[model samples]
Structure formats: structure tokens, C-alpha cells
Target: MIGGFFDRYCGDWSPDEQALFEALLEEQDVDIMAWAIGTQPVPERFAGDMMIKLQRLDYLPIDR
Candidate 1:
């Protein structure tokens, strides 16, 4: 999937990564939730904005 410093939690990085996300969000140019859970494919059963952010960071989960 994504090539980066991903860990186990990377799969479920939604609002969970608050600290890191907040910092990134402050950057403004970066995605707030560059990682997320429950999001896959184009249209997500979860939410689009979160998915979009994750996809942008290539941090969303792959269908296992």
C-alpha cells in the first residue's frame, strides 16, 4: 500500500492521531487525518473526507 513510516495503528489513524494530526493540520498544507480506518476503495462506507485525507497520505488500509 503506502511506503512510509507506518505502524500497526496506521490502519486506524482517524481522530486517534490527534496530537500528530493537530500539528499537521496547523501546517495547513498537509492533511489533518493523513491516516484513517474503515476506509477503502473510492466510495467509503465510513466517510469521504476522512478517506480522502488518508488516501492523500497513502495511509488507508488495504483490503486484507
Candidate 2:
């Protein structure tokens, strides 16, 4: 489900956001949940803006 959202919106994402999307796909659900909720440290490569993009997903406009 998350992967679907990423693919759907990612055409407009920055390169770093794209990278983080792929990285998230490679992770387990628990880890992804922790990262999304700020309970664990996001990997250095996926920190900062990448995490910010994901955390702000609720604000993303959906066509449907």
C-alpha cells in the first residue's frame, strides 16, 4: 500500500526522495513503521528531507 502510494506520487519527487522510496521498499514493515513514527533513527542515507517527505504524506493531495 505504501509502495503503491510512493510509485503513484514519486514521478514528481526529488532524486533523494526517489532513493528513499526504493530504500523503504527494501525494509521490513516494522522498521518502516518505526521510521515513519520517529521511534528509530532513519538510516543516514535516508535521513533529513527524505524522511520529511514521508512524514508529510498525510498532506499529499490524492486524485481519488
Candidate 3:
């Protein structure tokens, strides 16, 4: 549910923008990782779909 909101805003965003959002929102870990892809620091369990979604939507950052 919350991830939906995050991904929703990630649409049409640049890689840098996406990274910013994720970094800013990655304060806590999520339990619903069924659709998740990958984590920045790499969480114990991450949703692969989430990573692809962010990358596809250009929500992920390039280098920072």
C-alpha cells in the first residue's frame, strides 16, 4: 500500500530523482516484500519487482 504510493510518484521520474525519493523514504524496512526488487544497502529480504519498477520508472539514482 505505502510502496504503491512511492512507486506511483516514481512514474516519469529521473534516475536521480528516484534515488532521492528512495533514500528519503528508506528510513524503515518494509514487510510486504513479495513484489520488492532490491535494496540500497540490501535488506535481509527485498522485493525484486520493486527494484525493477523503480529502475524502469527512472526513480532510482545513478551514483549516489
Candidate 4:
């Protein structure tokens, strides 16, 4: 899931978005998954357009 997210969005990300993603990488995998799946509330620091896109999960393959 994370790989799909990175592949789809990382190419055009700004430096700040890149940094935010890097910081997200440091979080627990479960927390990231929860946030992406809308099972957990995203923290204020991580709440924004990027996170909103992540929550959409639209980049994922349809077959999956």
C-alpha cells in the first residue's frame, strides 16, 4: 500500500511534501495503515491534502 502511494505521488511532490512523507515513514506501519484506511484519526501534524489523498486510496490497483 505504501509502495503504491509512493509510486503514484512521490514523483511530483514538493520538498515539504517529501519531508512530510519521510516523517510518515518513521511512524509505525500499523498507524500509517490505520490512517490511510480511515480507521484512525490522522494527527494534526499529518492532516492535510497529502493525507487526504492517501486516505482516498485511489492509486491502488483495481484488481487488488
Q: What is the TM-score of each predicted model, taking all chains together? A: 0.24, 0.64, 0.32, 0.93
lDDT of candidate 2?
0.73
> Per-residue alpha-carbon lDDT of model 4 for 22-58, expressed as tens digits?
9999999999999999899999999999999999989
For residues 1-27, could you state the per-residue lDDT of candidate 2 as single tens digits?
476567657778888677778877888
Q: Tens digits of per-residue lDDT for model 1 on 1-64?
A: 3224244335666665545544444542322223333332332332444445555545545676
How many clashes does each candidate structure show, in the order listed? 0, 0, 6, 0
List of clashing residue pairs for candidate 1: none
Candidates in order have lDDT scores of 0.42, 0.73, 0.50, 0.95
lDDT of 3 by residue, 1-64 (tens): 4455475766766797667556646555452333343334444333344455544535544575
Those runs of model 2 whose alpha carbons end farther than 4 Å from true positions after fitting are 4-8, 14-16, 59-64
Q: Candidate 1 — which residues are off by over 4 angstroms?
A: 1-16, 30-53, 56-64
Query: For model 2, what is the alpha-carbon lDDT of residue 30?
Result: 86
Lowest lDDT 10-mer window, candidate 4? 55-64
